[model samples]
Target: MAEEGVMAHIPINHPARPVYRVLAGLIGLYIVVFGVFGLVETAGDDFFSRGSHWVLGLRTNMAFALVSVIFGLVVLFGAVHRGNLGHLMNLTAGVVFLVVGLAMLTVLQTEANILNFSVSTVIVSMLFGLVLLATGLYDKVGPPEHAETEREMRSSSSARPGR
Candidate 1:
């Protein structure tokens, strides 16, 4: 019952699912490109240096660039895959991006900022997080019959008085 309740809340076979998936993929591609540029720009710099290197309008260092490339690849994998794997990856990536953005924002003025994230980077991360979260919420996949059943259940549940 609990699982059914949870499933009922998520949209299956949504019309905009493909768009969301493509958007996620695009975000991933952007991140990958940024990371690559960052790596090139930060070459010969210290791994965690608070240098003046910027990539795609965001500050970066060798360490952060490497992390970005790896993380972006993971996101790309999630976007490319089908079914619950993509859903789970997107949800996890969204939470990670949001957390990283907040954490970077807090340390923007301190030496603890290992990634050398600028304000713009933080903003972009938060925006990407929101988009990924929204995509995940409505990215469920299921057969037409299941979608129909889910729709009926949702309608019936909404029609009933407070139960």
Candidate 2:
């Protein structure tokens, strides 16, 4: 009984396994939504020459929106599945975002960027990237072994109920 139930409840894997996946999924969803909003706001404009516009309060362009959609898809897929693949995807995306954000700083005054990133956009991107990167790199919590010992102890106690 009680001992058996306790042993059965011991998870085979780490308890923190779902944290990364859920975080990735959330990040992906946000990106997808903002991207779609950007696309809709800038619709009917020349894709290449589309002027910068703020969507969801973030400045962006059509190309950036498309890229965001693609990034979201990959991240979302990784989040939906469990394994090293998802972590890798999130790690890669985070790095890319970090690089893009840093690069945007150099061209803050210029108009050469297709993304038309602003100060807020750069800050947000870098922060988000850092979070994803750190979460992806975090080691999973190993299987709980102490539970087994507790179960055994409980079993021995339950077997002799004279006291």
Candidate 3:
């Protein structure tokens, strides 16, 4: 019997799966929060006058926040599902975070209020960028075999129909 309780996760899944998953989740959550914050600020009377004006007004930032939240959620689901789509989504998310972070860092720094931000926010944001970049350089874990199409798996697994 394969056991009726918690089944073992074999070695055929992504090895660095947890790493990417956690990173993606964190990134996604951050993005969601960031986006919400932006929306709130935008709706306020003094949003335009404080913080890095570029981040506050740029379309790219809006896109990044939305994608970040989405990627995080996808990665979280992938962690649970353990499939290719999840990892791919995470990879895309990481790439987006990395690219946006690098691009925006300069813009943020150039802003008049960059130096005025609470020290922790700046540090955390920088770390977030690095984590995303690292997550993008993913590693393959376990057997290369993974969730395949029904037709693909059928031809591949049908050799031993009674096994």
Q: lDDT of all the models against the reference? A: 0.90, 0.72, 0.48
Task: Write the residue-wise lDDT of candidate 3 on 123-163 in tens digits.
Answer: 45556656654554442233444523333545677786684
Off by over 4 Å in 3: 1-12, 44-81, 106-126, 136-163
Candidate 1 lDDT over residue span 1-163, tens digit each: 3356665578888889999999999999999999999899999999999989988889999999999999999999988888988988998899999999999999999999999989999999999999998878878888898888878888998899994
Which pairs of residues have clashing backbones in candidate 3? none
> Stretches of candidate 2 above 4 Å error?
1-14, 50-52, 139-163
Q: Which wins on TM-score, candidate 1 or candidate 3?
A: 1
Please, what is the TM-score per model? 0.92, 0.72, 0.46
Residues 1-163 of candidate 2: C-alpha lDDT, one tens digit per residue: 3437533443333446577668878988988998898888777766644376888778877887888888878778867766656656766878987998899888877867657778988898898788777656642223356545655666798899794
Clashing pairs in 2: none
In what order do the candidates fall by TM-score, top score first? 1, 2, 3
Backbone clashes in each candidate structure, one number apiece? 0, 0, 0
- Residue 49, model 2, lDDT: 44
- Cα deviation in Å at residue 98, candidate 2? 1.1
Clashing pairs in 1: none
